[model samples]
Target: MDANTISHILLPIDFSESSLNAFETGVAIAQKNNASVTIIHVQDNTFEYDHTNLHGNHKIEDNFGDVLNALADAAQLKLGKVPRLIMGEGPITASIVNTANKYSCDLIVMGAHGASGYRELFIGTNTYKVIKYASCPVLIIPTKKKFKQFNNVLFPLKPLPGVLKKYDLIRCMTSNNQETSLEILCLSSKINDDDEQLFEYLLDEFKERTEGVPTKVSSQYSFGNNIAEIILKTAEELRSDLLLLTPSIDISNKQFFIGPYTQRILHHSKTPVLVIKRNN
Candidate 1:
């Protein structure tokens, strides 16, 4: 999916501070890309209790609808004309995925915290699930991360077959501005003569595809046993504004199972992670 062609962005909010921060970030990105934003709040259906004898199901359902309307109205007022509001029901991750598909959103932006409770919707278990299952890319902003122009992006490259096509999507993120820069870190457990040749070949192809994009692109090789550690370290060292990753997953059983390295980067990276889900 080309992010540069983004016509709509999906922002899911829980009314928490982190979600608000995410909303602000999404607005900034929307403004930059000239993309319309759709803000959604998912009310968990599991929390709905059996009101057969109490207030009656209709009364309870009406109350829930009223609450959602109020929330949508408040969000629309706060966001101005840049966003359209949506109210969704069901499990948090499923609701978010469904809404994104319904809206044909090219990107999903949300805030994630490292703690549990209400904050868990974004950063806790839900965050991983969204990244794994979402049809589009998910941009995760940490609670403490403030919105800034993404000048430098750190991308970690794993030499898996058919993985090079993913670089085209990265161009979409930076295509809006010529000042954006990209640094690719190609990591391997060992570097031999053949490995160096292959790395150079891949790098050349990457540079070829990314040419004429106006952004500065550079690459380096790192010998490492721990891919996640190397990626995080390099990202921090470069002071990257965004971390781009195409997470490795196994879907043979029709279930999303994240790779260990991808999970670690999602949970530990301080910078915003732009998770580009690989097509099946």
Candidate 2:
């Protein structure tokens, strides 16, 4: 994104090491962009018999408030501004999204792992739900991956209908780093004369749009089943700092599923992922 593309950032914290790491990364971005920050904590306490109690909620609020205060103090030292922290009942996903919209947060930075820990994101938790429903883009910091200036970005584009539109989002994601080099992996299941022509045109189009940036566009043909594997491997091989993703588009048909491609990438990517869910 451009320096001003993000004016307000929303962070959802559960106090996991992963979430805390996300906190650090979010502040770093805010410092870079001169953006405002908001922290949200969702309380999921429900004892079916009695759900509403001020005392119980107060205890939980204190617990989250202590950590948030410490975090805000440190971040303020760097940002010269204090971040707003909002706490409410959960239904985690809905709370996070609603808080973001209510505060006019343009970007959400969150951790990839959930209760399952480092290896996987429970489909029902933080990153998945937030990306699925949030109005703005979500940046996911993977477990154990340190945040760095994005010098190289791995953008995997499948040659399905409407997939090329994702390139515009990639452009915005990398606009902040003029020195960033983008490696576009054009994946296709079946090769044809038309597809070959499309690849050539796509390469030219990508290069032209990235005027001051260094970019490389390559084609991986006849690779349908292993698209996710291919993308992860390339990002590793290139030592990419960020992996830009849109929802998966099935090449064989008109429908798409998040289970296969996007899930695999989120589950196993060593690089940070920026998920841009377009309204189309």
Candidate 2 deviates by what RMSD? 5.4
**Cα lDDT, all candidates:** 0.70, 0.69
Q: Whose lDDT is greatest here? A: 1
Model 1, 107-167: lDDT tens per residue?
Answer: 8888775223544323567767888888888888877667645778887876666657666
Tell me the lDDT of model 2 at 40: 82
Off by over 4 Å in 2: 1-4, 46-62, 115-124, 160-178, 213-222, 248-259
lDDT of 2 by residue, 190-277 (tens): 6668877777787777777766655555444445668778888988988888888865432332222354677777777778888765
- Against the true structure, candidate 1 reaches a TM-score of 0.79
Per-residue lDDT of 244 in model 1: 82
